[model samples]
Target: MSRPTFKRILLKLSGEVLMGQGQYGIDPETCDRVASEVKAIVDSGVELCMVVGGGNIFRGLAGAAQGFDRASADYMGMLATVMNALAMQNALEKAGVDTRVQSAIPMASVCEPYIRRRAQRHMEKGRVVLFAAGTGLPFFTTDTTAALRAAEMGCDALFKGTSVDGVYDADPKKVPTARRYDELSYDRVLADNLKVMDASAVALCRDSDIPIVVFSIRDEGNLAAVVGGEGTATIVRKPQA
Candidate 1:
């Protein structure tokens, strides 16, 4: 199969990825490693942006289940994402990559508020933009935010960097025989209830005609390899007629 080339892409990272081998919170070394990988991508000339999840610090749904109001819990989750974004920004800057953090919730004291045109300009200037706060709304996951931002930025693809290499028919960790898909149609993924991403996020990408690439970020150099279409990953998009 021929590789799909992308001029621009949005990377969606779960907060747990920054935890390294620890049980919780961000790990500085993990952030630096991810930053190095991102620097390589940016230096390779791919316009990149990112949305980091906050599940590691405080999952809104989990908090809601523990007695917090759903809205309040979700807001806390959003703040956690902002913290993750700042950590990533620091790592990227330390690695010599110009970076910007924008929050939908508009914490001007810390980072810039998200502005579409301004973000576009940042990418045009070869800077990486980290979008935080998940749409400034309750009841939405960072997966949905990643899809929305990818569409808004006219990204060529949405790259979901997770612990697993690709989408599996079952949880790969629990099911040793789980089948991994190299490519799947958006309809197939949706109908099968595949865990490539949140249903809303997958649907948005489908509507926008943007492909979602699911791959492992834990492995060094996987991001670049996947971006070049030479790594173990799954591509979800509309099927060719």
Candidate 2:
């Protein structure tokens, strides 16, 4: 079958991808490398935006489990995503790509507040928009934020860039026999707890009918390849009739 096409896409990046072989924190070299990849896509005429996770800096659920108040912890987690978003914006701008950072939590000094129409205008003018702070609410993962933003922006697809190239039946890093999926039904991902994304995120995407393409961002140039429909990745959406 011919690969699916996309005019606009939302790229969801895990905070861990910024670590660049380190135990923690953002790596400048890594950020620049990822920016280069993004620049390639934008230069190809694909409208792109991003939602970045904060596990590399801090995770709200983990913080809450470690004695912090759940709400406060989640807010802190949201702040971490803002940091990642800013870092990405810096890198992308350095790569000669116009970029904007929108935060759900509304830190006007640092970035613009999340305004859907404003963001849409940014993309329409050929700028990359980065959505930060998951849904502006506690307890929602950035995965869900990605889905929400993708739907709001009318994205053609959602690209999830992680360490693994695709979704697997098991943890491929741990399970030698784990099988990677080329495509999967949303129901199967949720019913079987496949973890391609959080349940709410997967359901939102399914509801919005946006295909989630899971690919490895750690592999340099893989983002462009995946966006071009020539890379190895897994696509999750409703099962065909």
Specify the highest-lDDT model's number.
Answer: 1
Candidate 1: residue pairs that collide: none
Runs in model 1 deviating more than 4 A are: none
lDDT score of residue 5 within candidate 1: 78
Backbone clash tally (model 1) = 0
TM-score per candidate: 0.99, 0.98
User: What is the Å distance of residue 143 in model 2 from its true position?
Assistant: 0.5
Question: Model 2 over residues 1-241: C-alpha lDDT tens digits?
Answer: 3358699999999999998899899999999999999999999999999999998999999999999999999999999999999999999999999999999998889999999999999999999999999889998899999999999999999999999999999999999999999989999999999999999999999999999999999988899888998888999987776
Candidate 2 residue runs with Cα over 4 Å from true position: none
Q: Measure candidate 1: CA RMSD.
A: 0.7
The candidate scoring highest on TM-score is: 1
